[model samples]
Target chain A: MKAPGYIFAEALRNLIKKRATVLYPYREVEKIHLPDGFRGKIEFDRPKCIGCQMCFRVCPAKAIEIIEDERGKRPIFLIYRCIYCGQCAEVCPTKAITLGKVFENVALRKEELEVR
Target chain B: MSFEIPIGPQHPIHVEPLMLKLKVEGELIVDVDIDVSYIHRGIEKALELRSYPQGLFLAERICGICNCAHSLCYCLNIEQLLGKEAPPRAKYLRVIVEELSRVHSHLLWLGHYFHTLGFETLFMYFWRDRERVMDMLELMTGNRVTTSYNVIGGVRRDITPEIDSKLRRMIEHLRERMKYYEAAIRSEPSLLGRLQGVGLLKPEDAIRLGTVGPHLRASGVKHDVRLDDPYSGHEEIPFNVITYDTCDCYGRVMVRIGEVFESLDMIAYALDHLPSGEYRLKMPPFFKAPVGESLSRVEAPRGELIHYSISDGGTNPFRYRVRTPTLANLASVAAMLKSRGDYEVYIADVPAILGGIDPCICCTARVIITDEGKKTRRITTLTELERYARERGVRM
Candidate 1:
């Protein structure tokens, strides 16, 4: 049973099978599998945030910055600095921060990536 | 004439930054020297600046492939410092995720190993199957590679009934694929030619060189951190330690494949016997650890991973040290690369030998000064290194 080219048969059969990867950028966006609760880009809800500074304190990457505005204190998330570990979302008392499924975080400017 | 050839600071044989100074005579390798000083991220020092909760993320970043093991070891070390243990349910959940990551890591290594050995078909097949495990990881944990699943008190999230069923299905599929690949690898003569008797390390030599993980197990020595010092509820799970007596590259491949099967079985068993209770203990985010030193050992996919920390009753550790498995196995690599008597090593066999240890150079990067004139090498402290550079008139 120590025959050479043993895997060739399997490879031949695989020629008919559909490709494993999807054309994500061009088409087949729906074909790309993203599981529920998948950690990706950061989304901040300013209304729900109590400005407890818990997210700022617990964030491993120091991605959250608290700023004072007309609505008391609110956090501005530097999405570029976030590791997407979801620590901020877990520690948020008011459930203000959540990791959305939008993993395509490319942006030209630093200001564009900030989630205030 | 014996010529000195450099494999890397950058080379195609391995991906990570590593330099192997090989002295070759004709086709035979006579002497070898390894330098892994590149890509040192200073993570140990960074851990000291961050608090316990923040340091967990830093620890998980030590190695992308074995992030689960690193984070688990860090949590165990900090939990010991706090003198608190995770609940029963959390421990079983930890085991499930830990084993799943282990399976994924082994599969990645096997596929990458074959890819390096010029077996592209096997490589594609292996990685194609690996996607299933990655999907399972993403389903169970939030992310895929850097799971960050383990926290100081326990796991980040509880396993849902849907996830449990999905995990079982993945395990079943992986088990079948692994069996077929194992049989294929054994019967394929070309693959066997490159693997069998390629990198020979005797049991005594393996132990003497301080090798750990599958590389050590492949030498016919039965030493596993899980069996010897069970952590994260590994004591409750029953599984056999797989070892092969071939004492070569073939054994290394076989040992990893066997481990994948064992990990699947362990996951199945853990899911069946998972205890029901509160998955996570309620603990504050930032807390001071007591003044004590704690050490933790985890059997990472590659080998033994050690994390040691000293807390000075502060929010951050006073000092932290990580001993990655790749660093320990580097000594054995030097031993295997040198040609001696009837056990000849050629230049072509370098990749086969180096890939056998599953080298992660980024995790093992450290500095050492070697004197060419004196033919001596010594590790220097940071202050000493700075002073040496200053005295030599190099701009600081």
Candidate 2:
């Protein structure tokens, strides 16, 4: 019911219109616009944190670790295994931790990923 | 050995290992039995051991392709369970991301299906085109693939003006390109000849087997979770539920292809009317739930993904169950496989059927061992020869 020879001509019409991709990072440092729920790095309030291990225990890959001292409670994220699910920020008992829009850090080595 | 032929668990066709024992009389398959549950990591079981917010992240990893959908569904379920509702702006943003994901995921499946059929040019064309959708997703969510956007009350960040403008431009470019795909479909006689009248699953057969998503819609079923039970501002976004009455493999593929354009229309609608307000509502960490059960369903790219959660007045969930569409739709494959004769024909049909529901092997199959089952000598994905050695060790 259809002709086979016209495949190339049809595909050519599609290719000629040009893709709409803009080089994002290079687009001069205007205000960096983002959508809702963008997974940025983890942020902690420090004051509201209740020292419970809700966030550290719940992280699937053990990305978040609870480090304690005289300062009450502190949690460090190993960014290498952080799948960016934001579980640590969400499960924070005291509403002390939240994810912010700042996912710029990149490290080649595993040790550079430790938040502590 | 007995007259048994095991087809998968490690085969060229299957995306994951799921062995099927075929008792054959010469070339004719007399008896067939499936061996699923081979790829199980108990993702639902993993979720139960965590709190509500902790469970959200684990849910997204259930399938990499529909990660956004998983997070959205989980977030909505938790929102319902918490006696809270997402604001209109947050709800609209959820619709945009979900529709964008549907476009990206369907095109991904198209590339893999064409690759399975040995059509290299078409495979490249589909994958190349799919990158545009990925760019749109990247603009919305920082990451290209694992975009865990939804939180308890609303989304995490906000869609800025620049991203919205870019999305609008991309939508305009794609609207015209969709016409070319339609033209290609009209012109390719070979593809039509192969696809039409093949792998016919009648209207009744599709419903009886609990088939969902485009597969059910292909058989002329007017049911869509979005239409039947609207969630996350899908009630406000204006889009039609695309369906066809043909009930063949060709119908299924065509319906999905056309739906990509429909999703593009949805993205435009969402961006134009993008609302304002605080992006997210905060939820308490250790609040006790009302000790009840709730179910939420979303029509994922594959099918309806239903999450059933039971909570008590505790930090962790009492029970969690996930009913993936692929697992439910796989019940229909045994019937579809019987019609095709010869090994090659059946093997080719395997990808089409498995792909029809956009099968995610990681979500569908689960391996459990009540006993060793005699330790039958077999091979694995590791045994398959590869030019590039896998980089396996992970430590910190």
Candidate 3:
């Protein structure tokens, strides 16, 4: 059991410690050092692609679509539906798709989210 | 005559969409009716349409806070169906994240519960500390809230040394804060006045109503899925099941607080004793499961979350059922809220009672909007829904 003034003493101690609240936008926050193996937006290495369809098959979100354009059969990534689970990256036989560190893929248009 | 005091399909006390019809005679609550049909996403049906891997994602989304539990249960269910287990190291990793999530959840609840009881200072303090847990989660799983870390075979990624060190530091920080909180909660007269002996739930009543998790534990029932039915190497890890025999709202708070400490210890143990092996099994991307049925139960932060899946040699499950803890605990709410001759319950105690069980109505409820005036009841099929969506084009 604690006394009534326990909170005040704790608050007084916390006053000296660094504030937990981050002043974002108004102040330039220190850059966050992302750990390795972080799952972010998918980066497709088109040159390494053999069109194995492994990524297309394993994608749980159905975010990856194999588009047969004039440039040959290539997977078109719909970031709008992408969950960033990175199953596509894991299942990619040719190591084509990699989950990059850049997670901020927000945009005005959903079309802008799509990555070929 | 008893008047109805309807507390929302939308209310300030809780964030989720749930309606409570409290029959009151003056300030005393006479009866209670809960409507949990406001926010059903038909996620179970959607899970049936998707493959095993796809279902994992949907399962994780069942409850944002208990995503790890849902995903773990889903994986265990599928693994049982396929007749394989995740590697030992992976099991430890699962325990690590799952327990971390539990800490995050318990802290989140503690903060939210105090807030509901009008303790804004404690709320701010709890939430401020909660950010550290969230940071640990983000560091470990990559995403803070919806951690898509737990995959079917194993986890999505492995933990690095930096993450391990950071997590330990955070756990130490949290341990100190929890100790302070425990002391503060025990001695705080105002908090005790609001919580103690308010919204009493007897042991028999709790068991009868099938109340699982901390709520049941609060009523002095020594039952936890982790202890009773150990999943994902829980048996290998040593931890105590914390329970309080107060049989009231105060007991629930104590139970959760005790759990935070236990979860912290469990995470540390799992990290220290983590085995070195393949995290995930090599399974084909899309494969049909042999005809079988498997049920997996996880001790989620709230309570026992059970997932049952039946597969008939199909890519997708034949039937999938999710029994969230909140749904089970809701039955006891009505019993607790009723004002008996001696055991009285007031309107102001509504939040205290409701918040005690840590209600996650979104996980329990499903919405089916009916057009009564038109007199048309339509059950839209997946194909029809898909066609409608396609015709509308994709809107952001």
Among these predictions, the greatest TM-score belongs to 1
* lDDT leader: 1
**lDDT by residue (tens digit), candidate 2, B1-396:** 237778888988778777777765555555567777678787777788787877877888888899888888888787788788998899888888898999888888777876776666677777877887887787677677887778778986688878888888888877776677667766778777666765677789888988888888998998888888999888888889889888877788888888889999988898888888877887665456678888889888988999989888677778888888888777776666654443223434556665666667688754333536786533334223222234443210
In terms of docking quality, how is candidate 3 classified? medium
The candidate, 2 or 3, that scores higher on TM-score is: 3
- Segments of candidate 1 deviating more than 4 angstroms: B369-396
Per-residue lDDT for B184-233 in model 3, tens only? 88888889999999989999999999999999999999999999999889
Task: Compute DockQ for each candidate against the true complex.
Answer: 0.81, 0.37, 0.50
Question: Chain B TM-score in candidate 3, rounded to 2 decimals?
Answer: 0.93
lDDT of candidate 1 over B1-396, digit per residue (tens): 989999999999879889899999999999998988878798998999999999999999999999999999999999999999999999999988888898988988999999999998988988999999899899889788999899998998899999999999998999989989998998999999999999899999999999999999999999999999998788899999999999999999999999999999999999999999998889998899999999999999988999999999999999999999999999999999998989999999999999999999999877788799999988777799789889999732
lDDT of 1 by residue, A1-116 (tens): 56798788999999999999888899999998888889998888888988799998899998989899998888899999999999899989889999999899898999989997
TM-score of each: 0.95, 0.81, 0.92
Ranking of candidates on TM-score, top first:
1, 3, 2
Point out the worst 10-residue segment of candidate 3 chain B by lDDT.
Answer: B377-386
TM-score of chain B of each: 0.94, 0.89, 0.93
